[model samples]
Target: MNGRSPRWTVGGPDLDLADPHFYTDPRHHGIWRAARDAHPVAWTESARTGGFWSVTTHAEGSAVLRNPQVFVSGLGMRLGADPRGVEAAAGRMLVVSDGAAHRRLRSAHQSWFNGRAVAALLPVLRRQVDARLGELLARGGPFDAVAELAEWMPTWVLFEMMDIPGPDRDELAGIMARAFDDADESAAGAAGRTAAHTEIFAYFAGLLDDRRDCPGRDIVSSLATAEAHGRPFTDDEVLLNCDGLMNGGLETTPHAVSGALLALARRPDAWRLLKQDPGLLDTAVEEVLRWTSPALHAMRTAAEDTTLGGARIRRGDRVVVWLPSCNHDERVFPDPDAFEIGRRPNPHLGFGGGPHYCVGSTLARAEVRCLLEALLRHVKSIEVTGDAPRRPSNFLRGLQRLEVELVPEAGNGRGAGADGEEDVHVHEAHEHVRATGDAAGDAA
Candidate 1:
């Protein structure tokens, strides 16, 4: 309120929520903090995406997410110029759909993605973690954690759940890494985006054809044979929904894991506490989720005129809720900036809330827990080798590369990754950016 202090007035130069640069830069927090104190719900205009409301506080954002009837998700969860074809096509996916259609599609695989299912897969997931760690340890030096370790769990688990063949895992993961990138500001990024989507659709379509008659217990089989409203899913429905799962499965977990590792490397006290008391892993996981809040924001369209945080939201207006800001909301989180490992009652919006809450949250949490457990068991200390490169996207707070050197625990024997072979196979870092700067927005 002070005229002397710098104000981030909405619709001015300080308010460009859709810009990728806003996310990449660190100064946005001061602006958001100011927004929370002054304008809880602020309006802004973008030349690229037109005009929309920016909801900065936790209470208003949560209310928006909860009251889906008012703040809808059907128009595609991004704030930019309307890509009619893409929005129309993406609407069939659960994240972009609303009401009965969203519920129906979500219910098809709801049981499989629940807490119980994730708990049951713990042993298998542990083995997967151990195997990946073994490979990482085989190489006797520093490695990019984003490429070598953090990125391993999600896609592998997704392929396993979907019963994708071992041979196809790497290729499919590559396609997925390419498909969701909307941060590339280059001309080639645009062409690659289309090509990547085409390949992904064709791959899933072929899998659907193969599994149509001889349906197995895989997710593809379940979807291939699922019937909603007494009718089977059309081919387009199946493909897009499959792609939706792939998109969800591909991005969030890695971001969390990499971010968690970065947090650990920085905060030695929390890292030591976890090492000394592994029982604190769950609490540590929650703190990590809160700190990372990887998926930055979710865009909702107003279905009806409503008043929120003392501002009138007109029907059909876009409401972009910043999750990172909500996670750092001072009202809910005391000392919101510190990375305290054992913070309790930490109900962070990292996974979001309401009907459109992340369906794969259970799996994501399990993966992070497993990753932390593996780190605590195997590594004594981890140090950052270089600056972490972030993916150039506004939506996903993802790391492109994270270089870390692991110090193995004393008395722990080395695994196959200890082999000092001249040539070792490691998954290199991937850079995916969409040319148009849409950032591949999601409901989560």
Candidate 2:
């Protein structure tokens, strides 16, 4: 065993926690292997929060999520150098509250994401997917998929479904992005992060009050008028719920859409296979979840001291679970690094596992299915034209600018193909709705 960490180290797990090597570089290999083999549960200090434990194996990690009585989500910096500070700043937000409290908080809006509600959203999602693909074509040729297509696509759909005031939609989205970055960048030990989150909550509070007095048909209206715990939600619940929806759906769905497009750019044959056989769509989505493993990691704090994979963790210590590492674990998956459509028992933690599984996973899936299904209909090939700028923060693994050509096969469809093309335009709207910065903060 490697003895205690040096006093000078940035963070534990014996790696450069500050630079984000885990996500952007191959250096993640040994660090993860070490964590998997011996140090499944470990502790480390961060500049912002002092220190926390790092959880890397599937069984042990799943244990933490399943037993919320023992661990709470949203303690913050699940995989960074700043646990003490982030945890200190945690508001016991929905993502952090455990057990009964989590139940009470989540109950405020869980029904809105139930299967019935999600199934009702399919038509709208498909239409939006169809329209957006057409819009990309109409706008014609070469386009930045990440910005023009990937970044705004799902957020726009979410805005419409949430019945967010279309006028204030863009600004609200920016606020959500700022809040997300705040949590992500806390490793830099910035005090402004808390203030930003507060600002986001205040704006959401005002928005919730407006929805109550002038309820409309959107999600805001639903939360305002709907009964929860025998009456309309309390003010805190209402505001936090909207904030949750915004934070939950904002960058996630978009990343899923774009991450797949990214995998395709590098693996043309996969796209070719999908275009020839659309039945692979379902498998393709799973493949994307496995290969990209969005959401990076989820953090949980020990309710009491525990041993994981033989590693002893102290009570109240923070443990970070690496979703991408688990997804790529050779122990659970064969060729874990390769993307394949027919991967069975995929069992990915992409949306997380156990009770806290992403509430909008079904919605996110349908949205991606429609988007990819539509993307294939429009573009024939996709290729990266230049060095893509990765997102600003380390937690999200995506490109800020994915320059590509959309070459439309003349007889195939009246649109552009995936590789690289410029000049075309098409647009449409969705009928239903539902559900990032930095490179160094990605996954291991």
Give me the candidate number with maximum lDDT: 1
Which candidate wins on TM-score?
Answer: 1
TM-score of 1: 0.89
Worst 10 residues of 1 by lDDT: 425-434
Please write out the lDDT profile of model 2 over residues 1-444, one tens digit for every residue: 224331222225455343443455645655676666755666555554456666666777677767766776656534552456445434434555556655555564565565555565555555555666666666666778877777776786677666666688777777666666633454443555555567777877777778888876566776677664565566766666566677678767777777888788888888888989998888888888777766767877776866666667667676777777777777888887777876887878888866577777777777778778777777778877766655654456555577876665555444333222111111111122222011111111
Please report how far candidate 2 places residue 134 from its true position, in Å: 1.6
Off by over 4 Å in 2: 1-14, 18-22, 74-92, 182-199, 392-394, 411-444
